[model samples]
Target: MVFRRGSSQSWPGLGGGSGYTASLGMLRAAVLLVSLPWGAQGAACANVSMALGHRGPLPGGRYLSIGDGSVVEFEFPEKSEGIIVISSQYPGQSNGSGANPMLRVTSLDTEVLTIKNVSAITWGNRGGFVVSIHSGLPGQAPLHIQLMDPHETPPVLIEERRDFCIKVLPAEEAPATRGADQVHFSENPILYLLLPLIFVNKCSFGCKVELEVLKGLLQRPQPMLLGLLGQFLVMPFYAFLMAKVFMLPKVLALGLIITCSSPGGGGSYLFSLLLGGDVTLAISMTFISTVAATCLLPLSSAVYSHLLSIHETLHVPISKILGSLLFVAIPIAAGVLIKSKLPKLSQLLLQVIKPFSFVLLLGGLFLAYRMGVFILADVRLPIVLVGLTVPLVGLLVGYCLAICLKLPVAQRRTVSIEVGVQNSLLALAMLQLSLRRLQADYASQAPFIVALSGTSEMLALVIGHFIYSSLCPVP
Candidate 1:
């Protein structure tokens, strides 16, 4: 009896035309005779072996490490396209005839690596086949190889399958020293010219901050505690949750987490001043959070990276954090000194501080927009959606927490602004310092989007508040 592929007919002897009962009896006797000997010798069948190029048999329970975008070949000493050759010799008998076993290769995760371009090749008298594997992102994926009985109707499994893991490592930057020098800047020279002016504006804003209000905050530290909790704890977890929910790519997710883990931005106090919130509380929270971030940022990133199954060494910019601290603290301290000692000079700074802040804000937005045009050219919708929503969500979370803690309305607004805004530049610095060029560029989108989103949203809120205040006079 013979069975052919794509034929709708059963084996000739097993057909149901006539004499089916007699044929069935004969088949049962034949199976009974063949089953006993087949089961006993099945264990002795020679299993096919596979090896990565020159690596020798994939090291039994070890993964092959390949850099992203690199190609690796798997070699098998059997000339079967989708088949494996197996030989079983009986006792006191010559070598058995080669059995053509079907071979199947599959990647557990195509995003990490892929198997393709399977072709046969000559390996002396015994022919062979090679499989080309292409690595994608930095992650681990299992490659499954199976041998099956090609003669079977549905191709039954011949024996246990072979599993090999491929670990794709991140592409390493060739010129490590030059990587630090590859700093990106806006094309417009005006942006560069405005940098010092922005710092001057920050100093001016510092002069306007009431020393008494800042002193009052130090005495009552509840708002500071709430801001820290929201900034470090709630924000990092929220970023992680959003990443998981939206299924962001690993690098992008890491970027988002790092951005969320950053300290409250310098812009928070500016927003507070614009919206009639507690500027002292905002400034104090920003400074305190920046200081606390030295420890808490690394902790938060480590915990969440582990959750995301990312094992790369994340570079946290401790120096950058300290520099930001100094940049903020020194200016504010100098301004406070001027305010206490030279009241006339302090009044001059206070008069121009608002205009300076407005000008700085416009300059920042212009620069950010220019940078975003380049960074977010290929940005995904999920990232944009997340970017738009994260600031709003953080604001709501902080406000609700403040309300629950029975804080004053001004302090609540301050906490909300502090929590919503993040130091995206710090996050960008970390990513650029840690990852390779391609990866750094790709990951940086999260920070850029978040920064732009937070700034734009806060500005809109400030304008709305201004309009409302103008319309409804305070009694």
Candidate 2:
């Protein structure tokens, strides 16, 4: 997985983007029309409703009026699939007054389902729905929604209206096969800079134990925040400048920017431990930088996209973005809570998990390596340039930022390790889900970069740890 810098604004929200509001409106509208009463002439109807969880409260009802004999079209969200429930109360029809109403549902204007004597029932929840129409002929429109009630003599027709807004989610495209022709690979090889992210969290948690042991000997503690900001914000620009200095191709240049810009990974704790540096500071920096990253990463990507002349914009999936906070931040906070509740248990779990986290991390690397082997062969000169730059810059910038922030020699060692590591594994997952082009454009190179990136991070940790340990022995 490669990094795309300054692409955060390209995300739907953040800078006054409308994508969030538009999505919410569609969701609200779908929930509003689940149940409505129709007048005597209202046997036929037009409406939409989403699935509610079993035994959960029903969503609010949406009301829309249609005229008899008029054609009504209902459009469901794109990729929506499931049973749509339809029930009606005729005008002047009192509750519990038995005037049995019947409705039919269908697809392609063909009668597919019939409901006699409507009963209360609800379906699934949280996502899209499958549409079935009853009554009126299916029109030329993309959605297959039509509702009609059987009435005496001339059954009144519901108006087919066009004012309702229904959104169609685009079909997920398969990955692209033209290797060199893909934009992410050939034009900008910068995407491969996300290597260290693969093991950041597990490594940091493991490393934090050591840091907590040595928290008191330091001359100052709070100033570590400045080092973290420098690590995340300052380093990327340095990477960008160096990439340009080397006259790297657009692909390689973009890759360098992404690598430097990414926040420090949890792995920094291990690297700190290896270096015999301040493990506590490393863990704290990792957590702080990651939280900051949710906002900075997207925004930085947005800005970098514009600056680097990368025309293809990427969006941050709001759900995934939100999930990251809960996944990383919440769990760490919970660990702290656990510590507060039962210090012994928390410590025991941390020690047990810390080693296990390493094993798991290694297993993850092994899996990534096996999967990424095919993509490895596809790395061209540009991709290689990115792979090479990340570690080199990570080391240089990691140390430089530590010094600039005036981190004490020992904490500087910790900051250096923290600055260089990243959660590339998570980034890879997001890339695969969010960007189909990653598969299409660089299928061959993508996996290789991922593997290479992870390997590079591991090496950085090893090297940084050894150097720091030699410089500062544990007192």
Candidate 3:
């Protein structure tokens, strides 16, 4: 049974499905190329009667031909903003019953991306988009592409509307198609739920501080620098090297780098207390790392993405990182500022921040784990090895670095745990915000693996510390 406008071919539906009773518009150059964010609406033009064929349509296979339910390949025209206009017939020749054709746009790359385009962004000359559409019911689709505050999705307009008799030529499976547009939100549908959980987790972080704790940091800039070394230098460098040594895939390697580059965990101070380490140093490391990550996150990402060849252009999520920094810094800063200005209020807030943070941390972890189960399923074994070993190595190298510098034993333990227990929550949040939702889910494979590993390994270390304390009775 072929799909109709309100058909039973049920795709894993993504929200907006309303359309207008539109006029016929031209394909290609006639439609306006405006830039807009995802979910932002625009108009469509339904004017042109484009005869989209494999080769016959627009001189040299430039327009997509919907040739009678087969695979059609089209070359994206130069000077176009990632938009490929196709038409079946004129408006008067449309099947007014409104049973629109269905099409799937797959990129030339290995991954199967469900390409959904709102509009495109163009440079003076940047041509790298190659894709194919599997469209049914061939001829010209007389869709009038117009600018609407509320427009039907751009990608499927020519094919979906029933009015045009499309002339699309279907292509067989090509190995490497072109790349453009945001990927489908197919894999991790639960990512929508995970995002808000991330926000709440960050909000609770405000309570994790005191003015006295922050002021103590200036006294030992040396130790703080060591912590930074353990964080920025040892952890990220180690993750990248490990990925190379293990021969991990590009995306997976990026994930590992992200996790290792992340700041000390919000839970670092608690972990230090359990391990008989310096809690104040742990708190200070968390503060500095979180605040400083505004720069480090993007910088480190640029370095690793280039080395790994993840993308050609720099699409780092600048605003998202800034938002994250604000969330982390403001809460801690407010708590510290309030402590000096109003000690009683400060004390009460910390008291609340400490306990609820743990509870929220647990709940958030559970939700994140549910969302990430699919990602972990796709991960191969070498990445698992990287995640498991990297944090443990951080613990070893951090302790060793501190010992070499002759920091007190307590500070050494604190540095070790701080370095070892990555702020995976921050990493996860960054993964979601910095990249497109689909990109985030794919890239998060290594970080989530590291996170799960961190959870288990940290538990083991804490248990060992308790046993050691019972036996040796540290005086």
On lDDT, the candidate that comes out on top is 1
Model 3 has an lDDT value of 0.54
- Candidate 3 differs from the real structure by a C-alpha RMSD in angstroms, to one decimal, of 16.6
lDDT of 2 by residue, 1-475 (tens): 1112211010011111134533563443344333322320122223232222122222233221222212243333222232233322223211222322222222221211121112222121122222232221111222222333234544343322233222222334544653443333223333233323432444335324443443552445443566556555776676566656655544344444554555555455655655557766765666667667677776776676577655444544446445554555555555555666667766676566545555545655655555554345455665566565565556566677667766678777776666656555344443444344433224234324634674557655666766786798767
The lDDT for every candidate, in the order shown, is 0.67, 0.44, 0.54
TM-score of each: 0.73, 0.48, 0.53
Instruction: List the pairs of residues colliding in candidate 1.
Output: 82-103, 84-101
Task: Tell me which of candidates 2 and 3 scores higher on lDDT.
Answer: 3
The full ranking of all candidates by TM-score, starting with the best, is 1, 3, 2
When summed lDDT is taken over every stretch of 10 residues in candidate 1, the lowest stretch is 86-95
Candidate 3 wrong stretches, greater than 4 Å:
1-216, 312-365, 433-438
Q: After aligning candidate 2 to the native by TM-score, how far in Å is the CA of 73 from where it should be? A: 35
- Model 1 TM-score, 2 decimals: 0.73
Residues 366-388, candidate 1, lDDT per residue (tens digit)? 67767656567789999899989
What is the Å distance of residue 250 in model 2 from its true position? 4.4
Off by over 4 Å in 1: 1-109, 116-134, 138-183, 186-192
Query: Model 2, 355: alpha-carbon shift in Å?
Result: 3.8
